[model samples]
Target: MTIMCSAESPNQPEIIIAVLAILLTLVFFLIYKRGKSTRRSILLTGICDSGKTLIFSQLVHKKYVQTYTSIKDNVGGFLIDNVFLKVVDIPGHERLRYKFFDEHKSAARGIVFVVDSLTFQQDLKDVAEYLYNILSDDVLAKNKTKFLILCNKQDQTLAKGSNAIKSILEKELNTLRVTKSRQVESVDPKTSKTSVLGEHGRDFSFQNFSLNIEFAESFGNHNKDGTNDIDQLVKWLLKIA
Candidate 1:
């Protein structure tokens, strides 16, 4: 004698349905976990003594960092709004030029360019140019990397105005574009003429691509001023989230 099977059973069907539901729930959870683990990285690039470390410290603690010695190409995590934000502070000193700014080209979702508005001198412009060349590479430029130029040391006697720093940055970025155009033209005429790059890269024809200066803000010097100035930085970073 054998027992006949039906499509639906009193207990077996219910158990099968429950097992299916559990499997579906587990699949959904795995997807959410993968998305949550995808981290966002912001690169901090600038000349030395430009307060890159200070800015990172301030960002981590949501205040100002008065006394941190310069940090090399180092990675650190800081908590902002309960989410762990990763910051890579590239060394800005002239001596370490080849090490951080030149050889290593890491991918970054955003760029925080620190500028020492107070102590900034003419020579710093050269450093800025070098940075532009590195970041504005054909591949890197294509990335939607946001820039936050922190014209720090605003409380000092020699602090430059926001407009001045803006001029310098725009000029440098523009120059980098022109330099790239000339190089490509020399190498590949089609790319140089028909090619669209930068904000202007082949994406558009009539209008030229421009670097979006997303945010420009001031930060106080440690000796005289405190982290009060960094409130704007914090706000800007939060806006990105």
Candidate 2:
């Protein structure tokens, strides 16, 4: 008769712990990658004639072509910096923009608000309102979508630069935050707190957002020096991609 039992190794617990830690790390990494892969839509939105379609054409078709206001989203793809970008050129029309944006929002990785810098001064209010809607959206916030205020049509003589546009937008957004706060309070006092944007008592800055908000100059046409089109935009798309 024989009864034999081998004792466990001294480092058995440590080995188990290390193995578990490695597995946890790998799981997290895969989850992160999946998140990145699933979110690939880069939405282009703004008021009409802001060069959204032209930019879309330039990227997908490789030609800077003038386009009429599209009624539906002009979905396309382009490759840059070794990344394939899923660009969804949502119609800039007021009615269609929101509808299309809401449809593809689940896949949104980033957003490019194409502004006609020349008309930015006159359209400041509308521009600010549209941007406020996006910034305040629960879905956009939850998705942590990145934003780029594309100060497009910068090649024209009257067009403003990106720096000036950013300053103007910051100021406008600051005002909108106050306005929205009041509106929310009047409608529903309890929900007002959640509707507030930026710091409660401070001026709104793009920096206040946890998600990235960038501004870059671009155009969909040939410039004086013949190099002011979507080059900057392409760089931005690649960056967010």
Candidate 3:
């Protein structure tokens, strides 16, 4: 006379577990896609006439491009060893350079700071200042972005090698740190815009940073056979990508 409750199915628990596993898999797949999409960018920047445009073109087209001064950012995407990368060539003109840096700072996976190896001595201070700014940037430091100090124009006989460039830059950055310390001391702490490059009381070096900083030589311009030393840079990009 009284109605009886139906017994639960044995497969009900298995079905519920399968549903949860599928949902978790979907979440992980989405996260992997988002990370891959956001992490494949490299920023190319340095003083004006440092061969960034040439390197950009070479990477994109496999040939040197005859470029006038770049007034704005040059962005391109290419594949290396099947990994896609978006390389941004930020104009090195003093007035326009920083704007691009601010825009792309968070998206950058690595930074290529080009130096005209032939003219490095004259431009040493400028290069150091620019690099110091990058090393001290809160976003870059926090992200631990990889930095490549590319000694461009290395095909030229007078072009400095990567070792010389590294040594000179380290020395110059040390001096810059001392000078910046004095300037910071003179200004009100609240109003001072300068960020310290390295440890307070020690000499400045790339090793002091949380990020990996590397130095390498590259010749963006093609040789007589239409090849260049840009392969080294491409290798680095592949590694980071």
Over the stretch 1-241, how does candidate 2's per-residue lDDT look in tens digits? 8989999668988989999999999999998789878998889899898888888877888765657989999989888778777989998788888899899888988899999998999999889998888887888878788889899988789999999988888999988888889988998999777777876777888877766898888876653234446777777787888
Q: Model 2, which residues run further than 4 Å from truth?
A: 1-21, 222-228
Q: Candidate 3's residue-wise lDDT over 16-63, tens digit each? A: 999999999999999867865686779999999998988998887767
Tell me the lDDT of model 1 at 215. 45
What C-alpha lDDT values do all the predictions have? 0.63, 0.85, 0.84
On a 0 to 100 scale, what is the lDDT of residue 217 in model 2? 84
Worst 10 residues of 1 by lDDT: 201-210
Cα lDDT of model 1 by residue, 80-194, tens digit: 6776667777777666754764433434545677777876667455656665655555544554455577777787777887677666655665665676689889998888754
Every model's TM-score? 0.65, 0.88, 0.81
Write the number of the candidate with greater lDDT, choosing between 1 and 3. Answer: 3
Stronger candidate by TM-score (1 vs 2): 2
Ranked candidates, highest TM-score first: 2, 3, 1
Question: Candidate 3 — which pairs collide?
Answer: none
